[model samples]
Target: MKKENSMKRALVSVSDKTNLVPFVKGLEEHGYEIVSTGGTKKALDEAGIKTISIEDVTHFPEILDGRVKTLNPYVHGGLLARRDLPEHMKTLEDLSITPIDLVCVNLYPFKETILKSGVELADAIENIDIGGPSMVRSAAKNYQSVTIVTDINDYDQVLTEIEENGDTTAETKAKLGAKAFRTTAAYDALISQYLTAQVGLEDPEKLTLTYDLKETMRYGENSHQRAWLYEDALPKSFSILEAEQLHGKKLSYNNIKDADEALRCVREFDEPTVVAMKHMNPCGIGRGDSLEVAWDRAYEADSVSIFGGVIALNRKVDLATAEKMRKIFLEIIVAPGFDDDAFAVLAKKKNIRLLQVDFDQKDEPTKDEVVSVMGGLLMQDQDTLKEDCHDWEVVTDVKPTEDQLKAMMFAWKAVKHAKSNAIVVANNERTLGVGEGQPNRIDSLKIAVKHAGDLVEGSVLASDAFFPFDDCVKYAGEHGVKAIVQPGGSVRDQDSIDMANKLGIAMVTTGVRHFRH
Candidate 1:
């Protein structure tokens, strides 16, 4: 039933046409027949490369507007048949099917389609490739007898092997098979994520997620532990990974973590702002009319704590700000952009990493925040909800002045980013002190008051959660705090309210808690 000395067959179908002509030409040079479908076949024909159409092989017209073209048994049987097994060869011979020795397939542009501006749901659904994944999985499953090519980067490797060894090696086929399965898995995960969001399914029965390996870090949080960075499949436009590294050595794990915290804190302000981050906590935050003024306020807030911290700015870095920053040792500086003179001044320090993140991109949508536990994972919606000062309820007898209310909101924003059991002491436009991650609220308040020192006289106070007891309020009063802002959810909220009134401290309840752990 088999034709004597027939050429090997390579089934090729891909949405990305990168290097398709040259790769197919090399396969032809190796005495392989090119089998393609739809747009791929037309492209091959235009490139003057001969190709056998899927319709010709299946002996059926492509129905459903070309969706049903490659789903036929003829194509799968050819790809799935094993050359070494006599029964498989007999089944192929009985069905008059040629053994397809290779399969080159990449799915449609579903990710690209969904990412397009104002794309409709129907448009996204139509772009999903059904037959391509089926073919890729079949070819990958039979990798013991068939070679699978999913990545365009592997085209040369496949060609080099064919040119040198007449066939791809067993190791190469196995690796490609594993890669193909990963590709299909990631593709399916992305589709599931998109559809789940479209249907407003908050908690899906099965949680499927995918990420791309962005970098292999030198180490994890510690030097002995190994770690790598995996970026989201659809990364947010405002993420640190989107930033261009203007100068300095590669970012360390700590550098990235601190820089991310700084960026998140700085984005909370609309005016020119600066945030200084150490570990994962903001040591200082400042907003001003000019970038230089903001830098001065942030630096003067806690000059000692910000010595080796990461700095994030919402505006472009100017020469004056750069000169001030050059005086201190900083791990990284992240900003929207940097002037030429500013860059030169900062680049003078060989070890500081400078990152330029675009501030003009559209606002990012809220995403799920996932944390890994020992045996399970915790998932929650990201806290991207903007808080309005007018929504706050005044719970105390003493009403806050406009300046004190502004300071309360400023401290509230800063405290939201700090770890739980956090406290922030701030003026109208700058954070004087911050304390977080304490075992008790009073202890955190004490640390914040001590950090603020003499500057705590007229500054307002913000707590991530309600006061468990009146002790925190009394301590804030003793420190000369002018006003307090908190979520006010505890059963003893009245006690804290009573204490605030006794101390003549204005208190506002946000009715919303921001707990970062």
Candidate 2:
């Protein structure tokens, strides 16, 4: 009489059995029948909980090496039937199928299987769940009549509701359905991406990316904006989004963006290099025999602006380098590593963020960069192509000296990270001045010259793009800049070249233009 009048049925099948015994026990206390298959049923029985086998529910034995158990209509018919519809009940009555009110299912471990060392293709393929996704979708589609649970984290809430109210509220059911759909979608996307790559396609025909929430930030770019950080389900090795934070408070949204920008720029060099950044532009960059010297050069490049900037180093931060760093008020400092003595010294500044990057692990940088607009996204290649002065042509009669050539290359690297209409002045290995985000090329050049002043002498100037007029070259010569490097593609390029020749300044054309907006 209790089974006929008050009992409810729950279908539970899961690969991850975390908290299964207690959750099932909670359901049983409220007169709910649990029907399970395979290892889940065995675990439930071992925990001294009652469970009806899939064979009893389907009236058929599991066949095809345990693959065909839940694929039967008996399971789906009960899970999907509309309780309010007479026709559905009539069909179920004719088939003697019990309608399922609650469904608990989680997908197979395809992602973990593929990540294991030496995992065979057959093993990965076998782990793909055909029945689990189908059951999840059916339960989600019937959320008006059924409750779905995909995550073990939701078990406590679900159990509490069923214990107190005897059923989940409509709002809870909708939310669970939404999560269930996302779970299956992510599972399918991983399988699709993995198989496409294994079949020799460099990229899949349809790119599918899935991410799990890592944290909810206080806010986005502004306090009014909402934001959350999500890491890839299968992360790449070199992504800063997945980097471990070694010290200091939790990273804010702005800190993550600026730190990532700083690190990416520093990776453009192989020598001992330091990059100081503000508002996503490189305020200073230095290369030296030691990181300590590099930090000083970079800081001296813009002592005032580097006060609250982020710093990135390509080599280890030693105690000497940390000494130079401890003087400045930096938002973040990241390096491949820090000497224990250096970390000990810097750790005293409790507020400054410190991060140790892993350079030994490797992954390809993203092929595409995406920008968000009002209604859509703008996407482009990540501009990862490297340029070399060795590939450049000497456009002026006066050849650049060996030292000047080296300085030009260094300035060229810095110019690429500056905003459009950019100009960077550098000596042999460190930046002297940077003029960025100007409306006109001449204005940017003037700003750099003013910043450099006497330092402009003997320093090479690097432009992000070709000069539309000869005035930039004239201005450079007046400031005592001895060499110039720019992409030579403008219609009046020869005019600039003529001015360089006339001013007795050496110039080289890199042929490649780097435009950062």
Candidate 3:
């Protein structure tokens, strides 16, 4: 007699049972016996569709709270046996195992489970499905004989092909097998990363990264290079990927990079602030009591560079701010929110992208920043440290006044976002000039002072790193800079200090460097 019946036998186990009942009913219509376990069987039986319990096939009761149900050899033997091999068929017949032609399995919701707020460790561990992945891998390995279905979206296609051909074609089986393997791989990578973080394991022997494709960009930094954007599987709250784009054309590769830079810089200020960025560098950063004032100050900081640059605001965009922005040509505007009239005014500029990012959400304490190099990858912790002016030490005889100290802090925050070797000249709340990505610190200083021009006098300066020589300090003093802050670690730190005291300029040592590369 034929094993089971003169028809196909399918094993189905899934956490997501969407469209499962109808699909199984269709299979039964085509003379296939449905075998299921746990919730799947209950749902099928409730829908008036007959299902053979897994115990009937394995001859073993599910133990350990349904964990050991489908891991039995009877289940694996049927799914993994090659119908083309005579010995495999004889062994199945001797063991009385019915050959399983189809295996439809999707793993537990591990990613969703761990993402829950205050989820217990035991709960997350329990949600890690062991039997499901085993079945998927086994069936995928024997794709020549067993068809695997892991995605719910593929139900219609698979069912249509089976209806037309009486069985899934070999080509369809191979494609489904490849998709199943990819699903399991991504699932395992997420689990590995979560467990690694729980154990505080740094630099594991194997590094696996999983990301979902968010967008396919028109091009990369250059028009000739093809590019795509991938968001982190568990994205941060304050991310460009999380932002809602209200208006404008699709974002290009350079637009995303510049918008990211603008967001990072704007986050450094809690007050009403605006950050202007171009080509992944800050053109100007401004802070004021109101959003409109902040926009004016930021625009005044670098009116020339502000053209065709990204603008990020920490406060809601009002009609006043929107009116001021409408006068210039900006590539993008990002804010916490935009008022009705403000959005209507700005939306008229069809080419300008409008992004509303939520600033109320808190970010994780730490995140891994990854950069890909030729044939290798580099990973490091993102620089999110908040510097306190109280921790800084004054090294010069000329003491900075309270106003000057505040200006130095403002400059520090601006310089942190600029590229190295970076320098920022600012008064109290607005950046007068920014110079970055120069070969030498003095050259950066010269560029900044030139940008400042008449405004250089009575302004405070901040550097990302210590002065290698006393020349930068001497140059700043001659240019009439009132105060300076740098990570004082150089061997010639005293020389810079002596120069500051000689020129009656106040100098502060932060003992920390903020280098952005």
Candidate 4:
């Protein structure tokens, strides 16, 4: 049986009313009646676009500050009624309820509320919409008989389709329904994460995460594997996933991952710092009074690894810095900001990925951190970057010199990029050597010393984790390591301390641990 195609009804409710007036008016022009609740209805009425109040449709007043407005069976039945089902039509007729043809809804600003300072639990709970999710889910589940619109961006398209064809296409309805479900899922995941964070259950087993795919990449690590970028919530900071490509090919999966890591590492410093990442691991890192010097020093740190790597800087990219960066072939170059001349210079490299990230918006929690085990999924908190170093305790015989102290702090920041069982040696704001992803602590120390070579003399070493034995300290001394920083929590802590005193190397315990694995 063919259903009647007379004036379709759309229920509109949105926290962000951007472009709502034109959209609602367009719907009205197409012989679609708008049913809206609370602020949305008020706004439409103020604009002289008549709307049926939700209370009129549901035959119930909005009590409890509008919380109980759309939760009734009338609302769900209108959205869920099967157009072709005889039983569904009979039920709707018996209740004297009109079937809802379309639902336009967006949840309250839970993500925004959590980001604001001093947001109380009551405030956060109040923002969680009960009726909104139910309506969205009902519309989505009955996509065959209903159309759902959750994003304002879809308003124009939906209006055009209805105007041209007298109804939305099945394909369009299916797509919108998919988007509606995704919206509700992401919203619920955010609420779950907030409650979990408040309770301090950060363990991987206890963590639950949900993210929507932002984009599918051209390829993964290689062209053979598939990859896509996802975001938990839209991050305000300079994020590769959020960046707009002015020109050049779409970023590969590896390019985005490496670019993100490099940007995060570089953004840690207020001063001009440059970080080059390859395959999601930092290959070169340096800081200087000027960005040009920093870029040059970082390139020199590991010129071989910097080839086709992602480079990130804390400060704005100037012409000189851009010129230096152009000398090498790179996959991407990201900075907090960029000057006109600098962007022009980089724009010439047609293939290089250029991104200007908002350093101010960079530190939100990632959507998910995944690790594949033997036929299982292992998830946990993202290896978030640390900003506090004041808690470090000096735990050595000789104290570090003022200059060495500054260099140690720099090395400590760099070491966070190294893989687990990592060792990093640096001096004068430059990474002298880095040993990462080794099986044992001593092997990582050996690699660091080997890479530093003669430069290891008078340099500071930073370990991502505590030393299990005194041999690591003795090895550092043999290579002329004069200062060390590690999270001192080994069973043989005294042995390592004694070894440091014998070698005359200043060591400090960071009380806090940074085990990447």
TM-scores for every predicted model: 0.97, 0.91, 0.96, 0.82
Cα error, candidate 4, residue 199 (Å) = 6.1
lDDT of 2 by residue, 1-517 (tens): 1122268999999999999899999899887999998999999999999999999998899999988888878989998899889999999999999989899998889999998878999999999999889999999999988999999999999888887678888899999999999999999999988888788775455767778998999999899999999877887656567666777888889998898889778877878999999988999999999898998899889888998899999898999999889987898998888899999988898989988887655335563566779997676777767776777999999999888888999998889899999999899878988999999989988888887878898889999999999999999998899999998999999999999999999999988999999
Residue 250 displacement in candidate 2 (angstroms): 2.2
Q: Which 10-residue window of candidate 4 scores lowest in summed lDDT?
A: 382-391
Which regions of candidate 4 fall more than 4 Å away from where they truly are?
Answer: 1-39, 42-53, 83-85, 108-126, 156-166, 169-174, 195-208, 234-238, 242-248, 360-399, 469-471, 492-513
Of 2 and 3, the candidate ranking higher by TM-score: 3
Clashes of each: 0, 0, 0, 3
lDDT per residue as tens, model 3, 1-517: 1123358999999999999988988788877899999999999999998899999999999999987899989999998999999999999999899999998888899999999999999999999999999999999999998989999999998888777777888999999999889888989999999999899999899998899889888889899999999998888878788899999998889999899889988888888999999888888888999999999899888999999999999999999999999989999999999999999999999899999998986354546889899999999988778888877999999988999988999999999999999999999979998999998999999989988889999999999999999999999989989899999999999999999999999999999999998
TM-score of structure candidate 1: 0.97
Lowest lDDT block of 10, candidate 3: 1-10
Question: Compared with the true structure, what per-residue lDDT tens digits does model 1 show for residues 68-179?
Answer: 8888888899878877889999998898888889999999999999989999999999999999999999999899889999999999999988887778899999999999
| Model 3 pairs whose backbones collide | none
Q: Identify the candidate with maximal TM-score.
A: 1
Poorest lDDT segment (10 consecutive residues) of candidate 1: 1-10
Q: Estimate every model's Cα lDDT from 0 to 1.
A: 0.91, 0.88, 0.91, 0.84
